[model samples]
Target: MAATACRRGRLTLPAFLIALALAPVVGGRADTSFDTGPELGQRLLRDVVRIEARDLAEHGFGLVVGVDRDDVYIATARHVVARRAPAGLVEPERASHAIAVSFCALPGAPRQLAAMLDGFDGADDDLALLRAPRPSAYVPELKALAPAGKDGVGDQVWQLGRESDCVVVPTPGVIAGRPDTRHTVRVDLHGALGGASGGPLVSGYGIVGLVKRSDNEVIRAHAIAALAARVRALAGPPFLLGEAGNIPPGDPQAAVADLTETLNGYLFAARDLNTLLRQEIVPRPTFAQMVQRYNGSVNRFKAARDKYDGTLQRNWPAGTLPQWQALRERLWRIHLRFFGLNGQSTTTITGTERAPPPVREQMAALEPELAGLQSDIARFAEHLGKRSIDHAELSQ
Candidate 1:
């Protein structure tokens, strides 16, 4: 029963993997030669628009692909936009909303217009699509829509994206293999870097995949067809017309305010957890030992909490820290678990009891502190629950 209850408090690997699999990819590509000439580059350039977003917490860069009359969609990895700010700055009621995309005509050109993100997915994909009011001047060489097929091992493909310092580059590679339908290609390309995310992977005249990451300089790109199919499924018919339009600028401020609250809530929750561990939970050696067995779970939580607090103080809104009073309530629940204080009220001590008072009294004292910790955690969970995520939105 204890184990089952404890399991409720843990973050399962499968859940984390699902989240990671759904995170958005960011950055641009590096330059290399392609069989297609400069004309192809110019044509593709028209479809590719630089993405820039800002918020109270951070700013980021991304790319927009496929534009039409109604909607001009920007493609990027979902992680770029969905990533939470360091936990320190998060407050109970505030969330860190993403900044708008700053679009420019060309690589070196000044930002021309601002755009906003429309929607995204948080499962099985890491793609996002942003919408702009008007088309930017620069465009990427748009390849024909990919044929209905899957890339095979030894298939030759090409990728185009920007590298560090926003230098657009291309790379050529052969398909290594398909790990899964969602994670399509493992290409053998030269030196992939940080910025070359959300770029195109082409086989023949059609787009085969989107640039995702480079593992030890080996490019790990995702299949375009797979992503497109997911997007079509999620976005329905409207996005297909390329008629996606920008959300009004007035709308984001309120959303940002809400996000700020959510972030603060998460931070407060972390602080609460820290207090509980330090006071009520840590005193119980068995509980401490259990956490320690996980090689630094407790320590990591502490470090992560401290880091988040520092970030919150620097970037978050004032006067939104977690309530100590609420934290006390949560500590009570922790005490119950530590002492096995349920059913017949018999104390089942797991480890040696070396303290002054009877174990029952010690458990009772811990109740309030544990309750306090839970309050903060609950707030953090709430914040996470409210945020919207789309893994497929990150693809281009």
Candidate 2:
């Protein structure tokens, strides 16, 4: 259940994965699109809605936060949904009276969700929290950001945007610095385009900041939970979070490459040791111990995989489920062979040294399975990025 307290002072107002590129251009101009996840229904795009400026007839982005009883709350930049102040002034000229939101419930047919003025903030902060009823299919996870230590220098991040055409595009960037303690995060990237005004800035760990006002040389944003005052006033739970920096979309492949390389390193060592032991270049005890340690490492990975299977259960697809099992079982067999060789005497009662089986063959057999599993991980990551409603009031 969502705690109905302020949780902590929202240090700032704040703010993914690439959603699919099928979004049609709003105008005649050409545009690029994104794909957070298409095979599975995406939740990030579903959570983020396109906000239409009712009277102004303009378009912007809104992040779906949790709901308050009958109404779901959305956090966005005040200027995106407000009437701008007079020239040279900072405050909004007047509050917006009417607004409509669209949800990604059915493919190509966005369901028109709830509408409201619900809340706003002071002149200095470009923050607004609108309350509306939950949508029909895509109830979002109102993920939160770290209230403290949101990020360190050089942390990678994603800038999720909604163009005027309603196409969701995600760009890459980083946390350059924080000049003050007001939780103002200085990002190192180009400012978001006109229609992207209320888009989100995320890191792998969590939501760090809302896409506040920005321009060249002054890429500023409000820290996460900066709108707790407004959120509490409207009856929504403050985000439960920590140091922000949700992983960028590109990282899944990077992680796979890195993890597989580590396994390759281990495989290489095992083969070298086996040859050295057979040739008597290495003593028996040392070879045995090294092989045992390798087995232990493989077992550890299996334990972790077992835990993952237990936790996710039927959520995983049947076809992909056995890839991990196959990988682990292959390694387990290799481990047992090494164990047998380690205990076997070089003399073998016949005064002949034991030779390890050909290693390249094992690697050849393992590589495809390993690569396939890695690909599955990358795809699953894409799915999670879309389905992740970390802060939405989901029933787990």
Candidate 3:
């Protein structure tokens, strides 16, 4: 990335340029599975800024990924501006002046900003973190770090960069594979250069990784999900690690689909089981028939819980993970109680027959829990429905 108190012109980094050090993707057909242009693109452009020099000597790019009360954190490749960085600089080298920034939001205008080295996984990884000024007047759409392991092979994604001449270019890539030697991703892409260092590789869900380097055959990125846990513990609060609205539903519609399927199953099973006792049957079924119905309902409930647990774990906010665990344990308790009711040896009861106090009380308590669970689930389903990637963005 570039340095400060200088004129706004081209940002030149080491010969490593982006290619010089950690510039920033490669191949595959464009994936329309998630949208990233115009709106989200504009927001990112404002953040994926051009790093300039005080004397107008160097240039490269950095992304504005996070912010706190005072500063905004810029994520770029260490090689791009690492030499000019004075904080962790090796001796004998002159301390470089502060860096200048050319933000896409304020085109043609560059501002002087101190680019301080915050934290970097040197020797082990190619990532670098820089702290910049974030005054009240400045605001860009902040993107959050996606949870690690959420991305899988075949997941479609997009890349953004400021390679040259101040244009923020978008490239499409797919998660092809991961290298065995290092914690780098092998993406099918090309065409990255000096100016493109430190760009972001975004999935439909949100910011998944940052560019490590690009080559003639493959584009590589240092996946951030795993590093996120470490980054959160860094010194500054400016690294607002996991903010909402930053990582929206990568595919909202798909998220809602599973929830609705299992939710409807739950609604039907609960209604049938509860109504079994309420209605007066012309010919009440035997105890075995009632037990079968109860068992079937219980099985359906357990399956639904598993399905729902899968969805919430993936899409729910990190803060809500514990809440989901609680819900899951509660669901298990409900299942166990119902299973016990089915196993009652002493009382053989038909649909219209009332059960013993203990069995009835436990089952009756489930009424309120089930009702509350359904309402909450409905709300969650609706939220997921509305939270999908914009239709236009995901379109081919």
Candidate 4:
């Protein structure tokens, strides 16, 4: 059971990472270790702009970090702008909703500048560029772009973000590591907070990356130069940038296959639960009752399992155990209540009132079936257990 719980925990980490990544960017608080230098302070304050967007009744806040001519680009996690425009809001099959950008000299001061929606991509880019109608003379002196470069392990970097009310002054840190395949750069910025997405990462000269989200509150910024290159390649010369292009056909198919495999593993894991109930426990119910209950439980599990499987099939992970365990436990308990053995009860049904001989015969036959279910369940459980152990060992 300890091992099982740990396996469930491992499965939950991805969802946790995603949620942390999407958390609202927080403003910076004071840090004695790193002072916001006079020159950097002016640049950071001027470059960091607040992003306010509306999708129907929903409103969102993010940070705008980069500017090109009249276009000011915001860097936020994809989940921040996940909502799509409702159908019929504009032309048939066209999206009408737009994102808005605003900024003020001071936190509570009246907005000094604003712009209507230009375009955005929630998936590949996770960055949105908004074009202002007219160039605002208030444009901050542009921070130098990070040279086209690859960050090595342990490179020093600094991040600027917002907490609740104040803009986070740049907090300095070193690159902890780079992600396996993604354009993620892990840093050690201390005191980074929520509402910090779209904040800038500065080295010596200019912006190196945009603070997207944190991993365990250790700052993680996306490589701005790399992201811009991808965006430009996919969206074409960045003219009024819009949605990032769909994943190429080949990639989507591979994603589908990966999802199918994961779901198969989960289903394989679930079958073990049913088996454990059937074989290890005793005083099992009449075969008919057993079948009826099993069928009902499995049916419900199938419904939820299928929903999750479909999501996995689409190459996305599903809910954590706490999110889905109630239903899972229901199935587990149904098996235990009927099949689990206790000492022969003092209160007993008289043989005269016993179920029909056919029922008894059927129940007798189920012993083998029960054994089979247990074997399958135990096998899958062992497999999943081994996989979990291996992952833990690797992490260690």
lDDT of 1 by residue, 1-396 (tens): 121334225533221112222223333321211224222333344444444334443333444555566555666655444554455876332222543544433555554444334444532465666555543454433333444533556655655446423333545577777647566578886665555566656554345667666654577766666666655665532333121111111222222233333334434443333343333223444333332222222223322332233323333344333432233234424423442433121122223322223434644565565455545656644543454433222111
For lDDT, candidate 3 versus 4, the one ahead is: 3
lDDT per prediction? 0.43, 0.49, 0.53, 0.42
Q: Name the candidate that leads on lDDT.
A: 3
lDDT agreement of model 3 with the native: 0.53
User: What tens digits encode model 4's per-residue C-alpha lDDT throughout 200-267?
Assistant: 66653345576666654587667766666655654422323222111112222222333233334334
Q: What's the C-alpha lDDT at position 329 in model 1?
A: 34
- Residue 309: error of model 4 in Å? 65
lDDT of 2 by residue, 235-255 (tens): 334432222223222333223
Give RMSD (Å) of candidate 3 vs. truth.
21.1
Taking all chains together, the TM-score of candidate 2 against the true structure is: 0.49
| Tens digits of per-residue lDDT for model 3, 251-363 | 44433454455555555555455544333331234333443444444443454444444445565566444554555465545444444443331233333355545544555
Question: Candidate 1: what lDDT?
Answer: 0.43
- Distance from true position, residue 270, model 3, in Å? 27
* Runs of candidate 4 exceeding 4 Å displacement: 1-38, 54-73, 83-99, 104-122, 150-152, 164-170, 234-396
Clashes of each: 95, 28, 25, 16
